[model samples]
Target: MLRSIASTTALALILSGHALAEETTHDDHESVTLYRVFVGDHADPKITAFDLDKPDNRWTFETKGQSKLYGVGEGAAVVAVQSDGDQVNFIDSGISLQSHGDHSDIDIEEPEALGETLTGPRPFHLIDHAGKVVINFDRGGYAEIVDAHDLSEGEVETVRMPQARAHHGYVAPIGTGWVTSVASDAPVEGDKAPERVGLQPVAADGTPTGEVETCTAIHGEAFSGAYLATGCKEGILTVKAGSNGPEFAMLEYPSDLPAGETTGTLIGSKSMQVFLGNYGAKGLVVVDPVDEPHFRYVELPFRRIDFALDPANARFGYVLTEDGTLHKLDVLKTEVTDSAKVTEPYSMDGDWNDPRPRLAMAGDEIAMSDPKAGLVRRIAKETLEETGTIEVGGMPYNIAVVGGSGMVHEGEGHDHSGHDHSAHAHSHGDPQIYKGYFEDSQIKDRPLADYAGDWQSVYPYLQDGTLDPVWEHKAEAGEMTAEEYKDYYTTGYRTDVERITIEGDTVTFYRDGKPLTAQYSYDGYEILTYEKGNRGVRFIFEKGEGDAEAPQFLQFADHGIFPAKASHYHLYWGDDRAKLLEELTNWPTYYPSSLKPDEIVSEMLAH
Candidate 1:
């Protein structure tokens, strides 16, 4: 199978100090990828940052009030907006990745608070664009613009709105000035803010530059490609850079849609030029600004709890419904591709601020905060399967992810030629083959020694009723019936190849007794942790001079990651390495060619 590679996330562009050093080429370099999750508590005035690479390594910072976290400055820092406390705090994520033409450099450090806080009257909506951060003070009737680069360097400089009246509105940076929501000057009763009427482009000094564009009851906003879209009661308001300043346009809702439906929350795709917005309660609208009939709606079975777009895989979006099922939406196809039950039912009848689940993407995994359980569940973005959960003390409400992949180059003057560094060894001369039960680490490029053997696919055995005993044994030990177990493995083990033989760097795939030989070179390994807290490493290899019909990439996953002969393994091959990594289903499993059907069943039951 093949999949497309999309653009990198903003985190991949934020480089650390070490990455800015003078460039030098190295003979060897190591690939490093890291992700840090920042979570805000519902009841406590604190935020926590967990290093996904090292689960035990985490840092927490106290805030002035309960906060919502946002990753800003292209992932170099996170802003904690405490609307109830009327203050905002900043934290340096300390994880940075920089792209340098051919490769990227990564730097990791302890996350810490920036010791800078912005205080105002009811700071509500925040926007990050073009290296600038804008915080709108709904009650203050003004907005403050801060340079993200300056914020990262311990400098706090703000450009404030001039003579602006109070309103529960928003402001975003565009061109050399800003596009802000315009509130009606009519007097209001009680402590309520002014009524939002339209939007206007303002100069850098907060002076209006253009006439107001009527966008009634303006609410949510997001940027995708060259367009910035905002939700409006009438329809959607879009903004783009213009020669004069900023150009604004209104895209009214199609007549065929429901009469009162509108989107209040919006998310944009990083890899594609599109936007996904929550339409009413049980529907989502996918918008393409450049195309006619810009909106397409997807109805959910239940009210949506929260939804997120996959930045890495751009075409996929995830929605969590009140029924506790996570549906994977193929944005390109405008349909649900897969669904899985991930959490207990979270009713939508309580207060809007009641603890509920929120979604954030951590690399290839989706981090969802289960407030009632006080845990953050990590689910695979591709399979929608629960991989692991991190326990947080109080209810974790809001979360933001920061980090990317890069290269760690060796210092000059060092030569490790002809040395085998693929595997690590202990001081007692034993190879550190088994990582800790809960520990996961990046594995280096390994040689073919780990898989140099003859293997036979188990799919044939399962189809021939040879694995019936194994399924019955599992049913006796588990909750499922024997027939149910058989159906599950039948779906999992469906493959064509019946055998494989590996010698040196060459591999032979036997299909229908016809063999196709190929040569491969070591690439890298990716470690995936399962729901049971155990991890498996997929040793990847790239095809070299080999059969013309052979796949470009091959991944072998066994229980071992170090340099040791494998007894059995699962094989995956595809043209796209990134896409191949996301394949959780249809893994063709194999056993030692010397093992008999009875012996294989015995080994399976033993596990």
Candidate 2:
């Protein structure tokens, strides 16, 4: 919950203020619809609200709560927690009171406080499911649930499983509710607490017995239908809460693979599924607990910090990279469709525990909460442009988005009484009309056209310490000299290249600038491989006529291993083979250095 505002984070606003500041000149008596972001300042223990329609606008809300609360939950209202572990406050998300408008008066209300009742060993996580807020205490191994509205009095269901030592757990709303237990045992005399907790399953009454199962590092849980999935070092723990309540099963990884760990997880939004991230692998393990327990792997360049399924479009989900880029993935194809740079390099160079930005998708907006900047960047779902930003006080850790259809009423009795209050107007100047100029004229502007299909950049740096290669260069409306061809080819060679010899297709050259050879026609089973030195090369090819254009079976004579052929396929360690094929197919799509060391190796192998 570190919330120091980065005074060094620079904001350059060079666009014409007149264009964006044009007055709407609405009916003075009519209630204006507004969505305001309220942020809690960690350093000052203060809260402020910003008008989403006007970036330069702000309002301050008084808070006697804790100064360093990690996550802010937005429900039918905005919930703010005090840093001192004393109180929680709620702000109406519906119609934010405007300071300059007719609604100048501030609407403030203090509900209930946790008081001394909340001061436990440690309040690790504050989670909200439905309207109930639960605070988990690690020291006491218990959970306290609160009525989100009242905050003072609610049900406190405490389950003391003897082997439960809090690591990371999540409470999901099923038929009732269930908490994932981080397996642990009671303290023994003269025995030091082990680094990892060996699993001892809880019986029907939440009591551990029987043989100790060697399971450690049980992270969070996500619910999909009757199944609740939890990520563990062994694989995944699948639980079903049905007629019999909750039943548990373990889905382990392939034994033949190298020993790595599994930590991160995200349940599939549409199906009876979930995703497990192998800290050791480059790809994501797609888990369908009821169907295929073994899971399938979807490879990508960077290790995903977080991902969100587009509730609007189930085929797509976004993966935010450490380098501050959001990658669009087609879940159906299990392929990356596009990517765009959103923020400056936060980097993966520091300690894994260091503060960084996390991503969350709220309605049509995709937001990244940058703890270092003390800002929440709001990206438009369609164009992915930074449409707006609000300054919050404390470092935001976890965010839960609810109440999308939320609306504001003039008063509690302002409910619909056979009357329509949505005053309609169609001005010639729709906000979207000037959106283009707004983009072209701004420094941080992102164009909508860029989102048509998937966009990818080359791997910025290769394992060999060389730059990525590029594939093609046009001869500006006329034929060029042989020297020009050679120069372009040399440029492609210096960089990594994606061989897209087909017309109208765009390909990238690696950072080093290696040019692709002439457009070659292929027929039958034509296999081409590229390997620079010993490591294998990963290449993406464009479909063309015949088998030559089609993928081929690649085998390395030195290693005696046949690598699979597909434009987007995994190539772990094919020294000479990777280099030659990359030389044969498309140029390099430079991946940023933001990916972790192990992630890069895994991504390359999977490709």
Candidate 3:
């Protein structure tokens, strides 16, 4: 789901061995070797190679006829495929070239042709394991699995949901094969459009209706041991890996939370929790599947452009904010540890599907896809330093790098006189980070801190009810009348109304410790409301009008409604109260149309 990409390469190194000999004895800090990043341009259809130690320098590799690549998959090896097109290429990361030491020796194979010619549309995503590739074509609505090493023939899995329209989908290889989202169901016979878009509005308060569709297509997916978190519009469909197939469970958000929500992006953590992005709220939300099936809402500081969890380091992950800063977030502590500006501002205005840079982690390098810059930014995780770069021809959208010296060249290859390192200079950056050799015993316990852009810090505290704000009304629920109380607590409200006091035909509302006054009819019929920035709250009461003095009171939630006397009414007697009037006018637009006013109000108070 990450798209930002830029490529710039540099060469620099720190002298080692003599004075640093003392630090080498320390276990936590060990010098890195054989670090490289594979970045694909966003504008062009090319993949660039960069040495992590020296990111400023890189080499660009043109794909088969310069076809646009949509996604990159990395496991035992790295595979890049052209979406909505036919073709796939694979390279050997096991060998290192000269600049990358003798460890990197890339063996490139000829690009393989897809089975079907111009079938509906090309592939949208590439799922690769070992040397196998599964390309899902959105237009055809079928997945073709091919041998990446040799694509002469392969297997094809057809996802035929006669009632579904495909958008973005993925296939899981290790666990369950493929599970798609349900975007739209088919119409009857020759109907132009489908009867429904598979979305049924729940309580306007943002509660789950639990309505199941005949079919669904999830946009994105990630695997954690045995679970696959599928991002869907209705809710996350939790798929548990089973011997038969993945088990499906739908989780919805609680109704008491704020409205406007959708889980657009999903990433599973090692701790069994799922990180989800709410496109409606424009913030990152964390959901503990074990705690509650429904997701919990936690607001973020800014819009999240791209994010990823580090499987190696669970304590923290990096988030690239819209402002172009790489924010190192402590997921465990739920706080930002550090941030640095890394790119130019790319507004989220224009098209919703516009191309933008994204974040990715490859070994010790934090690879940033800068579409505008047409380059990839490589930074070291430990020092947060820009080690190198790769200048790609077009904008790079997504990247994945995997390949490192396994045993630190336990053999004596240095006995040679001349080794060609310049050929790799254009692809990798400085040779220093990957140049010097290290003893395996010297780095046995060294931290994998060198892995940048993809590293995460672990959450120290247990994720559960502790992080949620306590609901004070829960403990005192039994004290109220069971019948009348049914309408007392607003299970959910469009706005947070702390309290409302009512007396003989008059009412005065208090919001966050401030008194608000308004007008009504009847002998007293009083009303009061207040506006705080974007928040608007109102209180309706019927009691004898009086001043702030000994006004009759009616209890609601933690708030009290009192009589609104002449003095309070005069403050808002005319057009000066336009803000409150505007808010009330628009209240119904967000209120649940499915529920009655009394039911809606009661649920808000109780929630």
Candidate 4:
């Protein structure tokens, strides 16, 4: 659940070996995981590593006295927490290699400890925040933060629940502080849950700031964009970003749901501000922080085994039922879109520590761990088909993947730092609903839409103005007025979309009397590529729909080899799909000569 990825986006390693023999050059290669899964054996002190490319081939490593693996991720490093009382250790997940070239073979090495911190009675939740790892010592009533890069020892901060004893505490880092549950001042009551719990903003320096926010029998928590959702007895607590710190707003439990309703587990969207939460055992609930009245609920036939969201694919996530069926959750639509039985029913009427089915997302695949069967079943993306399974030698209670794509130069002569490409900073920035869009042939048909008409375009230029401030949300709850929201979000589209005829799959975006046809390539995200004089242009698609009916608006960004200071253009099909022209158009009065406008173009252009 916790993945501590190193800053790989900023780090590059050389790969070619031919450089010493002659002059050489290198190109950029994006990060990728080499290994598929690391199954944590509960029956023994070992973890089995599975190759994504070759599932039959596997490797097992001994973890000594540790009986569990908490945070196994494909990030730069994997973390294993050891609870050996006062000698607890947070050790290395395993050895993984990264390169700067196009491709590099996976390296195998012995496992060792990354570092150590307070060896407490028990270290439970291991969360990866930003780039650091937070280890929660439940027994010690403290949370320790360690630098993910070096695993250096960090300060341990105390936490206390105001009314009831904190059986298990949580800590999530935001900006320079943490959203933490307080440790109770008194011991927990017998065979009884906490009547009320309190949460507060805790600074990185261990001091509590802002007013303490309270919830009843608080449990599940999740984060997305500028919003953080925490589940409690009443409903969900939404913490919004703020200049002073984060502020909490309570959303009461749904009125029609009746009594005895509470959320035990929560998973937030990777981009949108919506959360998938467990409503006791009745069913699953999709809670929107801003819009709470229309909560989407999907009932379960049996109890839940485990559920997880696909970090890379925003459209669908999955839920594994105790009946062994994996249901595909159309997140935007908030419903069960597809389902398949992955394993035999694993009843939930047993001890909490009993081995059961668990779910996780390994890249684009949905992996289900069948602890009783000692197997990990993977579901392919898009198709919702069985991709096959991998066998671990023991009870695979937990699984995590470690390894990413990298490159190595042939010769030592090439300077890795010398490969300077156009910034394309807008596209390079992290994927956002407006900032990026990708369409894979596997996800949908060749073309998503067809248009042939004169589309009007209204262009807005900040003129030497950075879109950052307009796009960034600094409010406490990620909530803004209609006017405020439109200002920042509308800046990405053009109001003046001109002549364009789209009839079926044939889309001829005319440029200077010539047509730029759509041809697919590159990770399926780049929908089409066309030539503009000496430079080439690529169209990428993205949607920001939080509903399952599909994205109401399609976002396409034009990524070209253009200089940063040069003018550029990006737009979308007008909001009205019928005529494809009547959409909201707002004009920017100021256009500075230095900023240059986006080239949407001659007969009109692609998003």
Candidate 5:
């Protein structure tokens, strides 16, 4: 699931109105509002999907499991734990979400239960790794694999983690290999060696590769960026798909920190490789584990009740306390920037099951589910104040914001042929392009168009890789042989140069992104040389076809494979630099202090 973050905030809507989307005579447009919030009522045994903006519109579906064990994918699909039996309930989380170019919608539908998956005993952890479901059982110490689309069928394959405990561990499927935190092959207790666990690799066929990357006292696990990290007493282990296979690198803590620090709890960011975690009862740590000068911490006012990273607002982390105040954390600055009292002081002194305040997001609003009050608190993300509340009968446990505003075509046409319509005039009774706001309405600190740093765009598209759409799917369905499918459409791969930011001597390659410390010097014109310990590559920023002098392409003369029989390979601004891209792509037409769409368009027209 692509981390689809909330883009359009409430402030922008109130200030600009629908003028942000200019009605154009382009094509068919649909008017839709899709912010749907799902709350799992533990006492009631139901999952409810309701409009975050308007709570009156909602749908609740009965659930089978009560432990609140669940997972929510980016596609707005929900899988709840069915602890009573060897099955996990699959619910069609009625959020019809769609994102294209720079626009997204939060469309909602009546939530329905699709089916259930045959899982193992005590399904503890759930993770949707590239559409496949991984369910971990606590007492059985086995990880079950089931088809995410059709949970009713499939012989549930399970692999056991032979740790000397009742399975308080975690598992993640990175590509075809499953990564799990297991006890270090010895008779070790789960709570003792907080870092004395090995991140063992389980192959796609449920066979352990026997490669155990060691991490002492590994407790909690999470996915931030492309790496699946396992928290330890000493530091954190960043596990990512490497050139060979899943690579594990240890990011150790500074020597000067407290003697008994352990990473027991962690919440990672989807936009970047960062984590916000509990250092102790009254302390929190912000870690960019692999980057230089990697660690930072902030002292909390009270013990953390719960914390979640605001991926939509990438710079901040949301933390709730027993004191009933929600604190906003700044990742880059490593400080608590904003605070708002969500509920009356609900101390974390009682039993863990005692009704406590929960923190979540309803689009751009911060939602705190107060089970004790039997109300879901909504706080304005812009003003950080309590906006309103929605009353529910039971204690809301599992919560997620999914679906988005998208187009639902009203008019109908039966023609279904996939043909080139470029020759025909699209102006005759063309579907009116409804005015809509861009999905980037939430990013306010920086201009949408104004991005600084050494950016790398690659060309010829990556030619070596996995995941083919047509032929592979046929092979998977047993409709064609594997050899036959490979002969038709060969597997394609993309290089590490998807997107990058280089400033000074440091560069973070954001695709198969890796941080590199290099020395860059100008060779000639826009041509430059990047040398990292003797290995060097030539980089040139050639002018794009637009306006002749406009820089829109980046090319690497060395270190990249060139297309066969091609003259040169260049990374154009987008997929292609052809005139067609200019028409299909809705780019930033103007850059100004105020991000009003109408004003920006007017300025561009005037120019």
Candidate 6:
């Protein structure tokens, strides 16, 4: 059922540069933030990439068969597992973020397929952890461990496990070796493979190193912080990195709870040290391996359609039920904090492969694919409001998101050793605030004069015909069609504000020609670095005297790191400054009020 690839052929193909891309660099101190959504079609042998920052930009790659996509190498690349075709293909997501002690540098290129194609029989489960990808080939009765970094560079070198009896099992990397499933020596029956009995830790050379831990009917697996967990009918089997080797334990399901309940599929939190698993058809359980009363069960109203955990916001998990409701689960609180109707009713009574909605977290938003509707809806995580939608042709099924904020420093041959240490400091405890060291001399405290002027919103110009030329110019440059560009900007520039006027410490917001003024005082600033190697500085101001309805806090972002006159700017206001910073969508932008529509179009085209 599986076939091995020739390493020499793969190396030759990659060296020919047939599927490699050139890296992209940025000027010094320039920040770059990009997130890409990879969508696999329900039935087609294709995958589409949607760049979240550039709405009009799209890329589709042909595959041997339909695949289930997974982002690996910390968002640097993606692997497409084609079980039916017995193939595994690698994709350079064209986005790489390298971390320094204080900040990270990002390099972006065009997405391309790697020359290597890992062919194996009935490739099933995949686990990406500790800089490696472990792919389970069920029919082949083996697993291949590939270094993620090498795969991203178009190199193919896999450490294959010694072949055993063919069975539906899994293997995961742990403590320099691996923890693999163990099959019983029971007599075979019919055409079905032998069932897995337990798990045993093996040396890096595929030699067994420890006794098998009893875990019957083992199915799903996940990694939470330092521990790797797998589902078992008897209990939750856990493995941790030990000084000698991998240490294993079993946390049994509490007897006081339901009797016949067990978890199958598991999801782990990246920010918090916890795991969320599906307990039966209409229930979820939060498992804490190291704590007492390990399992906390949450009963759902209906059978689950799909569930995903927010990697950035570790405290939250999302579940979409067959009733068309998406419930937001607070993992720390072990309860559903909020619920919203996001899609049409997707009944559980259907084929397991039926087209349904899948959830993926993109930056601060949650992307849910509505396959029947041929759309991917973007929902704001905090408000759970539908912010926008992407019309992905055909049924968008399995989805994976990659990319984050990174810095693009200027000039060639710049030494990364020399980091800017001025205008920044380290802080912790507040999860809302940006953690880690920030080395930017340009980011500092400034007065309100940096934005003291009467400004107009660009949303109106985009609405009228004044901005059509800008779209046409973009279309001419082979981005998107003029109409498509217009549609894209319609979502980007959407705002209710018509104008904004600032004088001294007073800020006035005009909506429908009515002015609401408020007074504010300086409340310091925070520099936020994104996963894509880009960073932003938010000048915070707290309301001192203002109208009853005015927001309590205001943050100004005009692409200016320090004190300077702003040509145009985006403003965020709310009662919570930390919560306001999480608002990536619906930023009401402002330009000089004196500029005419023609002038505005010219300004836009120049950028």
Per-candidate Cα lDDT values, in order, are: 0.74, 0.41, 0.41, 0.49, 0.51, 0.74
Q: Would you give me the overall lDDT of model 5?
A: 0.51
| Clash tally for model 4 | 51
lDDT of 1: 0.74
> What is the per-residue lDDT of model 5 for residues 259-285, given as tens digits with 9 covering 90 to 100?
587777777776667888788777788
lDDT of 2 at 384: 70
- What TM-score, to 2 decimals, does candidate 3 have? 0.50
Candidate 3: where is the Cα deviation over 4 Å?
Answer: 1-32, 54-59, 64-74, 84-86, 95-120, 128-133, 147-168, 173-217, 270-273, 276-281, 293-298, 352-355, 382-394, 412-607
lDDT per residue as tens, model 3, 46-73: 6776555555445566664233332222
Error of 1 at 448 (Å): 42
Residue by residue across 97-160, what tens digits does model 6's lDDT show?
6432234446666688888789989888999875578899988989988976577676778988
Off by over 4 Å in 4: 1-33, 55-57, 64-74, 82-118, 152-167, 187-196, 292-294, 403-607
Candidate 1: stretches off by over 4 Å: 1-24, 410-607
Local error of candidate 1 at 4, Å? 38
TM-score of each predicted structure versus truth: 0.64, 0.49, 0.50, 0.58, 0.62, 0.64
* 10 residues in a row with least lDDT, candidate 6: 14-23
Residues 1-607 of candidate 4 have per-residue lDDT tens digits of 1111111131121101101111122233233234446676776776676566566555566565444454432243455565543333444444334211123323333334443345664666666644456766665666666655344222223332221233466777654346777654555657443344767887665577766688766676776645677788767888754434566888887667646878868887754557888887758888887864636777877777778777767667788888878888887787888788778888889787578877767666767778877888877866667788777757888666655443322342222232211111111221221122223322222222311112222323322333334323223234555345445335323222222322222222333333333311221222332121111122333333122222233322223222121122333332323221121122111121111134222101111
Identify the superior model by lDDT, candidate 5 or candidate 6. 6
Each model's Cα RMSD: 22.0, 24.9, 26.8, 17.0, 15.0, 21.4
- 1 or 2, which is superior by TM-score? 1
Off by over 4 Å in 2: 1-51, 54-74, 77-117, 126-132, 147-182, 186-214, 255-259, 267-283, 371-374, 391-402, 406-607
